[model samples]
Target: MNRTNCGYPLLFPRQNWRHYALRSLQFAVALYLLAFFLFPVGFLFLKALQNPDGTMGWGIIALLFANPVSWESLQNSLIVATGAACLAGSLALAAAALFWKSDIRPSPFMELCGFLPLFMPAFVLASSLDIIVGGHGGLPAMLQNLLGISRANASLLSLTLIEALHYFPFILIALHLSTRASSPQAHAMARLGTSWRRLIRQVFVPLALPGLAFAMALTFLKVIDDLATPLALGITNMLAPQAYHRIAVYGAQDPLAALIAAILFITSGLAWFASLGFIRQNVNLFPVTFNDNRPPPTSASMRGRFFITFLGVVYLGCYAGLILSSLAGVWSHTPLPETYVLTHYLKAFRFEMSSLYNTLIYCGFAALIDILVALPLAHAIAKAPPHWKQRLGWLVAGTLCIPGVTLGIAYLALFRDIQLPLSNLPLDATGLLLTLAFSIRGLPFALHICSLALNSVPASYIEAARTLGCAPAKIVSRIVFPMLRFGLLLAFTLCFSLAAVDLSLAALLVPNENNAPLAYSIYLHIQSPSGMNVGSALAIISFALLALILFGIIHRLHRRQGSHRTLSPPLFPTHRTTGFAHESSHH
Candidate 1:
């Protein structure tokens, strides 16, 4: 029987029971996404455009257009977003070029270590920076006192720099993946005596443009939507901070806050679509092929080793600064902490244990729900009809484009007056809403990872099972599920860590102080004059927990990789089954 573009058999009629089941499952997932993800966002736009008199209008928008505060905030967001994206993209591209293309010989462990900042909470990273470089009490302040330079926080610059540090790894990883696919072009051009500069400018850059654009777009969205960094830095004029302040201070009844959220949502959506276009256009820009095109590994030069060492030391030093500050009894007016003790850690664990428990409960539940929702959607996307596939992609992308802050704002608007369907509880007053919000916000990540894993399942195995009269359910249980164990674990861990420290949703959706998660509690502590040490301690504990989970995932993945390598030599005849698809019969 012939197969459609995907691996499923086309000989089976469209109305086949299996196909119908798949369709029904996909339709259900589509409905869930629409009702829970898309509807709230649509309602946000509607609310922003509607006046209080229950009529369609754009008066608020008109007023916002005329407001100088809106324009200035927009201007600031654009400037900072653009600047941070460029800086991060350039630095990441350079790093990828050196590590992958040049004789850098950057150890895989070192490169992985460099990506640690990507998983750290934004507030934690921001707080770490303040400890290392804040005006009156940090190491940089001490240096400034000696140099006689004025020692006030450089708010905007500090934000940009902090964002760049957190975001560069994303671009670096994207470029690295792109280069993996296009390395033959680089090797072939270099063989013809092309200068490294020309090779990058003419060959690699165009090939990697899609990934580069995506990295920049993601960086921009993250920077623009960040409430923690600006709030932590005490910046009030920025767009995200301004929007947050309106609702946080004036309550959710403020129409102006909804207007700002609408603007943020629209801006985020435009950037996401624009970046998708760039990605699609650049995907096959340099079409070159080779039968066996792996490039030979290069050795590190002395200079290259020195460069990697320098970056490694700088990153380690920043982390050390956080750890040291967390342990300091009193750190003011000193080059280093005057007294180092375990009091801060004890205080955090003793006093903030409830907050930590709340984080686990919330994030653990969210991750579980995220996986449950993602698995069916991912399976459907991989096996659904073409038209349905496109619709599913849009659904996922639309959810991804909705910023977390916008989602929080949307939920706040939509459910502030609604109660649970059968219960007397207000929707916003229970942990259910928080968990639902987190699961929806994390859906895109879970779906993407699950889809990739599902795509990698060997078609031959499924075909063999089908030919033997095995049901679809049996094939999934015996073959697909077993192979996907690692990926599922990875998705769950990533979503859990992210949801655990998600201040954006918790800051708005959480019922009250008693139920706040660790990140929210840390933020609360950081806001007080005497609470910096406690906040540092909380940040330390949170970072350590997240790091442990991340490292566990990494270790398991590495072990799986090694096992795959050991088993591959004897698993089957030479046409290898990899992440997606097997070699054609010609091989």
Candidate 2:
């Protein structure tokens, strides 16, 4: 027997039943991943390449190449993505340095505020911008008067601005974690009398290059694949909205939509792979021991204070605009609303009260499914034979790079009329299909969180239990489950909130208003002429509820973990350095 470090055999299965069970579980997981993810994506390519008569069609490919709008959409996507990536990454880098590295007052609250937009759905932010900047024509009018810019130009800029704000948190968190990981090196460099600027240039930036690249790549992919922002802003010429528009106008029969989806799929896939490569290549560039010893905060500079204050004002303005827009009755010509009214909320609730139930039910089911499936999957990967671990990890992470829009389109193409296994029920009936879609979309997040939790558990603890003659089932229940409770809670909450606010999946997978979650409902409201205020109201409510629940749970988890262990690594891979990047760097 090949005994392992934990006193278990390298190939631990002694009973035939256990081996059969493990094989069965692996088979089931593989089947689901293939059917839901890989096969559907492959089907999307087939649909993109096929003629109306179900035969191969190369003419559509040529049409995509020749169409001016297709080319323009692609161009606009590249421009927007590049611009958003640069802006977001730069802003995040600056903000992370001030809030985390400097000796700022109320650092915890500042960090939370910085992270607020990550939990907010993009549509909510878009609606808020429309209300403050475009709905009343206040900011656009002011810009027109001062700079001779047109309202259309103002709207586009606002769109870009809001996108950068929404994505800033991804890079901010990434850089924050990466910087913390290299704090010892940073402090050592500081003791050598290195200026902040040079320290960043010589040590911090180089060490955190992987995280910065990952953040930029992730942001670019997100901006290009985003459907809600462009759609809410009435910018149908962009690639994501254009693809969605074709599907809405021509239904599933449109190959052009599939073609556009294929493009997004390829673009996002490449970005995702590039980010992973960067992170892997540089993760150990300046490796340090993980510990709880806190580094002394650096002295705050006047410049850092000013930068932090400016970012705070921006976030406060956006959040306030969202809340006020929901309550404002009208203010066409003035900077402020003419009257504050609660009617919007009243009307919105009257119409969408049922949608609240729908949101809760779908999110609840999605969370349950994610936890159930991801836990076992994480266990299998972490405990697998060493030869199989890397392959299994990659398989779980396969969808991490796929854009939500691409997955939404692929699911629509494949599950439009499919039947559920072992039941007479069709997949598309009564929002069941949407539920499954949300689960699949959120699986990667759940798996990642659980894997971290599982890996954190000591091998000696499990070995001791086994030596005491504990059954595997009992050990899992008494030891592993208890240890993972906080992580599982966090994962479930994140998965549920994500599902509830997923615009891409909800837009395509939801067949009717009854199936619409809060995000899709907000989209429909924003798009309807009579329902914009109602949409704003709904956005406010959803944003508030999500912030409250997620923040409350996360705060409690952090406090508990802080007592004994350190925080988890950043959700996205980004890195930071010695000080705020110079403001001119953004230019």
Candidate 3:
């Protein structure tokens, strides 16, 4: 009878200690995630069920289906997302294939151009696209005069072009990481009689499909969650802006947003789940044994090289417009526009301080904390009984497919009336809420990266250190950690960049202007006529900060690799890594 009632009644003291410690840690992290990211999402869903008199009801969801506008917006969002995913996925596949398989003469410069979008924030792309279309002396005006096409007719296509360009880099990174695993294999196969097309279809495509699918899912999430482009493109029926406007202007709090978000979450989550299961089934299908004896030789033809450079230039031109526009003389327009000025930058720095500060405070703290929690979890996962490996792996990546808005909504729901036992602080404090949100949001990415890093650390090292009578701390501080620095740095940089640009949750949860971050600040500035230049300037400043951070990371990695030159073959077998820190690597 006692055995049924008491969990530890028959347990050994050491076993009890280990079990309780692990469970306690798990409980704490789970609570933290739910409190900041999941609960608010639940709250939003609950709100959708509530009646107008604050009573629980399904009227919100009913209104969503009944209203054509709401349904239309959701439909439009799906269309746009699908289009962006296709364009991005195809382009990334081509570029990755070129770099990975063919003896494509490596173009370091072209690589830089191709990846410029990685550094550009979402709002800036939207703004630049808008300016290119609707602003005074913009392309629409020229097209209207030359081709006799109306500006209204040209604007939608123009915005789509801009979004495709901006979203492409996200898909590209996933493609790059996915294909890197295949490139070496494909190269060796190319030397055989297998034709390029056949090799691509057989070896490269199947192997890289995982990355491609992952990219598409991520792009879908990003594009669907986007709030800036609709405003820039002037599409009121776009899903993101609709949800934004619903809460901000309508005050109606339509339950449809919740239903739509649930749909999005379910769809993407299923895709990611299927992909992970596929990956696990095939993780070792291609044993990674290398043909070091016969590495593939490339025959990059002159025409191929030229085509690569041309395509790279086209990619570069998209973001160059923003880089140029951000620093443009106020009146300049058209091809090869006049002198670049620093005045815009000076103004930007002056005005964007609060937003910049908030970005740093939140991203820095949250990413760092996420890493600390994650490192332990990763270590445990890596060391867990081998039987649990595949199950736990998917368990971690399952969070990737969760919709961004759902996480934001979760935070809102969980914290509405919740309080801490010690201090009576409300969860509504934007900074606190933001820190938690960012951390929980970052968990999936961080966990993925850390798991890979930890797995790469050979068990032999830990075992040898233990045999030498080294303490657990000593072993970790020495062997395990030294090899993990690069991965941890990569994880932190990516998490920071993401948090810096995040607008959805911050916009919804952070009510005070004083507590606002860069994304919110830009959103507010863009809301008013007087604030356009200031907003543009602020946007440019945020872009520069992101770029600088990226540069600093690359510089550090170079320095680290430089010192390890004697042992490690080389960091840049091809010096074509992009500037964006997030785009640098998978692990």
lDDT of 3 by residue, 292-387 (tens): 343345355444466566765765554455566556665445664477677766776776787778778987898997897786676556545544
In model 3, the runs with Cα more than 4 Å from the true position are 1-23, 51-60, 105-119, 133-159, 180-193, 250-257, 274-301, 330-340, 383-387, 417-426, 523-537, 556-587
Q: Write the per-residue lDDT of candidate 2 for residues 1-587, one digit (tens) a residue.
A: 33442232322356757667776776787787788778988999999998766788787788787889899888778777888888888877776665434523334444454445445576576666556665634444555566778766665665677688788866775666556544455556667987767766765565556667876886787678778877666677778888888888987658888889999989877777766766532222112123335544445545556876776687668766667867888757787888999999999878787888888888889888888788768767756776576566655665766777777788777876778789876676558767877889789889877776676566677777778888877877887777778778878887888788777777777868876788788878877767777877888788678668756764664566545343353332223223333111100
TM-score of 2: 0.86
Best of the two (1, 3) by TM-score: 1
In model 2, pairs of residues that clash are 174-574
Per-residue lDDT, model 2, residue 163, is 81
* Top TM-score hit: 2
Taking the candidates one at a time, how many backbone clashes does each contain? 0, 1, 11
What's the TM-score of each model vs. the native?
0.85, 0.86, 0.79
Indicate the TM-score of model 1.
Answer: 0.85
Top-down lDDT ranking: 1, 2, 3
Candidate 1 residue spans exceeding 4 A from truth: 1-4, 8-24, 52-54, 103-118, 134-154, 180-192, 280-301, 387-391, 562-587
Q: Each candidate: what lDDT?
A: 0.70, 0.70, 0.60
For candidate 1, write residues 497-548 as lDDT tens digits. Answer: 7787677788888999999998889888876657777877898888677667
Model 1 local distance difference test score: 0.70
Pairs of residues at least 3 apart in sequence or in different chains that clash in candidate 1: none
